[model samples]
Target: MLKDNYGRRFYYLRLSVTDICNFRCNYCLPDGYQCGESIAREKPLSVAEVNTVVRAFASLGTEKVRFTGGEPSLRKDLVQLIETAVNVDGIRRVAITTNGYRLASQIDAWQRAGLDQLNVSVDSLDPQRFRAITGHDKLANVLRGIDRALELGVSTKVNSVLLREHNLAGFEQFLDWVKVTPVSLRFIELMRTGDNRDFFASNHVAGRDIEKWLLHTGWELLPRGRDAGPAKEYTHPDYIGRIGLIMPYSRDFCAGCNRLRMSAQGALHLCLFAEAGIDLRSAIASGDHRDLAALIRSAVCGKSAGHQLDRGFTGATRNLAMLGG
Candidate 1:
């Protein structure tokens, strides 16, 4: 089994298939930037190329894969890529992190392709606020998409990044939305990435604040059960679903770290806050599976205990869009 400096088994891989997205979320990219024009020159990896990279990591004991992008569902061949990864020998679970706007139409196709779960990014329920945050007024579309996914029996989760002045006050309403459906709600702390430092400095919300908010709602947060991501989960009294909190900045889970990432163009990231990455595309293009597998092992070994964002270690300067966070 491959392990990082934390001694936790590093088996999760978050792969980005594209860097271009339809919406310009304030936290994810530069404000008002043109999507297609600002994208990098390199084309996204083909399904076969992504499959090769998945095989290399699976050979070294990687077990779970999460497809992400500026918006992964935006990829025309997303289902093919998901199917390819699922068929890999050691891959046990497959998931995707999306903006939730395209899900109403694509959920059925995605489920048919063997997708295991989903994490939809929904910043605010209010239409005007949502427009301000995402630079689009598609809040109604996203909500309908969520309802459609829940109705179709797909395991869904709502991902709400807690930004201080923006929508932190509406967190309880988000939790209430999750309580009615089978979807799990995850409140993530805002990390310093891209131009986030310039727009909002005090927007970083911690896990403790979430826990306290849950208390006022007469819910009891269950204790930590497994070594999943940084999110600490809680259960509401008599409620069917649960809530999760990811405090990457306030409370670091560095010692229990167990994940790695792959950029859209095919660089493997050992840590989300990493400034540099190892090129897996070059080895794959050479058509040497053995060399590619060796490179993956080396990359895992180089995985940091946790990102420096937690330690006030802010050396990484890459935008979250490029990093596929």
Candidate 2:
């Protein structure tokens, strides 16, 4: 297994196929943000390159691979990429985190290509509030996609970013909606990252308070024994689905960190709050698999003890979109 300096075994890889997104969520992208000249000129790693990186990680005991993007569904070759990752020798699961705008049309193709899981970002069930949060009027489209995913027998989950001023009041309503769905709901605490610092300052909600409310509302907290993600999960006897809280700022789950992040540009990130990363693109381009593996090991071994966000640390300089949130 790939063991970091802190003795954490890294087995999950979150790979970003592209940094280009369709929606401009206020918490993720800055206001008035647009795909500009730099974005146009930027080239993400090729499918072959991504396969090579995945092979290296699998060889080092990586078992799960998740494709992320500004919107992974935007990629024309996503099905092929999923096929490549899932067919890798040691890779057991391949998944994607998408906005779900294009998911309905492509769900069949993705399932046939061996996608094991899907996480859709659905912040609000109310139509107007959904558009207000995502800067798009496709709430119905997203809901359709979610329904299709469930019908297709795909293991699905719904993610919502908790903004104190925007979505806090809708928490109970969100729970009400979840009661009728079969997919789990995860509420993510907004991270204080670049470009959204001011918004985060005003809208960041503590996961602890959310937990208290859930407990008071009769949701049963459940222990996630070996799951690798950051969320603390819960379930209610009366509901068909579960609820989760991911508190990156209000609480630290770094001690159980088990994944590494790879940017679309091929930078290997050891932590979500890491300031910088080691470039594996260059090593891959050199056609030296041994060298590339060594670089990956070096990067993991150099991971910091923990993200110091609680100690007044903001977050990575790159925004969530750039970092493939």
Candidate 3:
């Protein structure tokens, strides 16, 4: 098993498939994605490379792998990528975190390709606010896609970053939606990144406040699964859905970290807020599982205990889009 020096068993892998996002949220890509000559020159990992990488991780006891991106769905071969990961011998779960741009039109194909879990970013329930936050006016389309996934019995989750000035006041709408949606309604705490310092200062909202309110309202905390990502889940008898919080700034947040990130460029990231990554491009391209595992193990041995995000140390990540947070 991929156990770190801190004795944390790594069971999940967050794989970035691309770095081109369509959303320009106030906190993330506010000015829009800057697609330039650099992007044209450098391409993301190919299907064969991803297949080899996933196989290595699966061999090392990684059971769950979540595909992320500047919008993973943006990749035309995303279904092929999903199919590749699902076919790996020991992988038990295949999931994706996307912005839901093509979901309404393509979720059926994804479900057919063996995608079992889907996480869509829905910043706000209010249509206008959603547009303002995401710089796109497609809340209705996304909602339709969510319904389609539910019909197909895909485990779905809706992620909304808590923006103090944008969606905090609309919390009740989210709570009400989850009351009947039968999906995990997750609120992600806004994080400080290299380029989003000013935005983080003005918009960050603590996930703790929502937790307090949840407990007071009869929501019960539930235990986390070994292979689950870092979400503190809560459930209530009256609601079909569950509530989850990803509080990166909370004390000892990294103590429960069980996932490792691998950039689309074939670099291993011990922490999302890591200052640097160990390149594994050659190993991945060579399709040598042993070589890849050895490099991965070496990195895991020296993994930092925590991200220290509270200290204002934003590492190599200029924005969440860079790491698919």
Candidate 4:
């Protein structure tokens, strides 16, 4: 397994298939995709290249591989990518995090393609509120997609970004919906990225508030999975579903970091908030698996203990969409 200098061992891999999202989310990308002109001639990693990357990680004992993106569903060969990861020898779980645009329509096909889990971004319960937040009026359809995933017995999760004075007031509504649904309802704290500094100041809601509320309301804090993302999950006896908080600013947030990320263009991101990255595109494209594996090991060895978010340095991450949610 890949171990960092801080005694943290990596077992999960989050790979971006593309950085081209269609959502103009108020928090992340309010004006839709803005770098189309700059990247118009740039092509995302091909299917074979993605396979090479996944195989290299697997060789290094990476057990979980998650396909993320500006919107992973936007990529035409996303299902193929999932299938490829599923076939990797050491990869135990193959998942995808998407916006659920084609979920309701293509979920069955995806299930057949060997997808083990799914995480969809559904920022709001109310269709109108959802529309206002995401700039899309398809909450109903997205809900349908969630329903289909549930009906198919797929492990489904819903992620919402808690924005101050915007959808924070709808926590109760989220509670009501999750009371019976079996999916995991996660609220990600609005983080201060390179470009969202002003917006973060105006709307950044501390996740601790919600964590306190959950404990006060008889919710039981659950233990974190070995290879799970940074979400402190909670469950209630009465509720069928569970709640989770992905609070980047929380104390000791990065102490348990066990995952590594790679951009669509093949740059290794030590942390989401790390300065740019170490490029492995050439090695990955060269089809030299041994060289790529060596590079991954060397990169993880130099991993820092934590991010410097408390000091107000956002690093090379101008926007979350540039990497993927």
Candidate 5:
């Protein structure tokens, strides 16, 4: 297994297939935001290059791969990428994190392509609030996508970012809706990234407060015996679904961090808040698999202990969308 100097084993890769998105989320990007000229002109990695990167990670003990993006469904060959990742020598599962705007139409094709899990981002259950948050009128479509994924037997999870008075006020409604669904709901704390730093000052809600409210409102705190990524999960014995909180800023889960993030442009981010990255695109384009694997190992071994967000440090210059969310 690929272990960092901190003794954290690397077994998961969050690969961004594209930086283009269909929504202009209030907390993800500024209003009227457009793709930068450089990003507009640059091309994303081809399926062949993505396949080679996945193979290299699989050889280095990567067991789980999740395709993320501004919206992964926007990628034309996403199903093919899922298939490629799932077929990698040591990969056990392949999943995606999407906005679900275009998912319902392609869910079956994704299943056939060997997708094992889905994490759909749906911030508000209220259609009006949803439109206000996402700057889109596709809440109905997203709901349909979620229901279809559940109906099709896909292990689906809904992720909502807590935006203080904005979507946080809708948590009760969200939980009520989840009780009838076959999927879990996770509330993610707003990170103060470069793209949303201004909004963070007004909208960021601590995940602990959200968890406290959940517990106070009849939700039972379940013991998370082992690491389950960054989310702290809970459940209601009577409810069919689970609830989770991802608090990157309020609570640092770095000791258990075991994943690496590869941007759509091919930069390998060792830490989400780190400004610097290794240009794996150049390495992959110029080197052989063995050399690429060596570079990956070297990069992982040098992963930082934790991000400096607690010290009033700002996050990466790129927005969550650009960083694959």
Candidate 6:
């Protein structure tokens, strides 16, 4: 098994399927953004190539896998990739994180392909605000997608990135939105990544702030234990699903971190804000799957006890879209 310095076994792997996305969210792009240029020259690993690496990870005791992207739904062959990973030796859970614009159409096919869970990036309940944040006015489409996933009984989670002025006012509104629906709501503290600092300051809202807010609503919040990917979870006693907080800034869960991330093009990132990555593309393409797997194991073995960025973390503006949330 791949073990980190903190003695946590690295069992979960997040693989980004592609770097292309339909929506250009402000947090993901710079001010006055333009999106015509293609990074196709960067060369993303083929689906089979990805699956081969996954099989190696499975051999090393990985039990869960997550598919992500600039928007994973943008990948047409996503279902095939999902099916392949699910059949890997030790993979028991397979999930996808998408922007939810296309979930309504792909839900049935994806469920049949063995997708175990879904995390949709949805920030605001207000249509206009969502349009401003994501640069897409298709709020109706995403809303329908959430409804469809719930109707099919998929284990769905709605990921809301809480920025200072952006969607802060809608925090309670989001809670109410989940109250009316079956999807669990997660409050993701917006990390200082991309050109995010340009649009807004890094607002470090503690998980207790969320807990305090929920307490005022008289909806008793109880710790429901930790979920995957650094999100400490809680559930309203009267609510059906849970409320989660991903406080990478205010609180670091590096001690309990049990995951590794693979970039869209094939770099193995030991930490989310790492300055460099271990190259696995060349090893995989050389038909040395074991070497590529060893690289992953070694990367995990070197995972820093924790990142120093929590105190004064300011991200480099050039991180690829697929790397961070």
| Span of 10 residues, lowest total lDDT, candidate 6 | 30-39
Best candidate according to lDDT: 3
Q: Candidate 5, TM-score vs. the true structure?
A: 0.94
Which candidate has the highest TM-score of all? Answer: 3
Q: Which tens-of-lDDT digit does each residue in 1-325 have in candidate 4?
A: 7888888988899998888888989888888887754455457789999889999998888899988888999888877988889998988898889888789998998899988789999888988899999899999889999999998888988899998867988889999999999989999989889788889999998899989989999999899888888888999999999999999998999999989999998999999988878988899999877789999999888788888898898889888887875
Clashes of 3: 0
The alpha-carbon deviation from the true structure for residue 112 of candidate 1, after best TM-score superposition, in angstroms, is: 0.7
Per-residue CA lDDT of candidate 1, range 231-280, in tens? 77778766778888887765456766777788888888777877677777
lDDT for each candidate structure: 0.77, 0.84, 0.92, 0.88, 0.82, 0.75
Shift of residue 81 alpha carbon in model 3, Å: 0.4
Clashing pairs in 2: none
lDDT for 144 (candidate 2): 91
Model 2: per-residue Cα lDDT over 1-325, one tens digit each: 7998778887789999988788879888746346672455448878888888888888888899999987898889999899989889989889999998898889889999999799999988888888899899888988898899899889888999998877788888887887888988999988877577688789988888889988998988887643346788899989988999898765447888888999888889888778786777888777565678788987787898888877757556557877666
Model 2 TM-score, all chains together: 0.95
Order candidates by TM-score, high to low.
3, 4, 2, 5, 1, 6
Q: Write the per-residue lDDT of candidate 5 for residues 51-141, one digit (tens) a residue.
A: 8899888888888888998788888898889888888788888889999889889999999999978999999989989989998889999
Report the lDDT of model 4 for residue 238: 94
Clashes of each: 0, 0, 0, 0, 0, 0
Taking the tens digit of each residue's C-alpha lDDT, what string does model 3 give over 118-159? Answer: 999999999999999999999999999999999999999999
In candidate 2, which residue ranges exceed 4 Å CA deviation?
37-42, 225-227
Candidate 4 to truth, TM: 0.98
What lDDT tens digits, residue by residue, belong to model 6 across residues 1-325? 8887678777888888876777767667633334444443467767788888788788788888998877888788898999999988889889998888898889889989999789988888899889888888888888888788778777899888777777888877877676667777888876665455555465545566876776686655454322366676666666677777777755546777777878777888787776666778877777666887787777776677776665545433253365645
Clashing pairs in 4: none
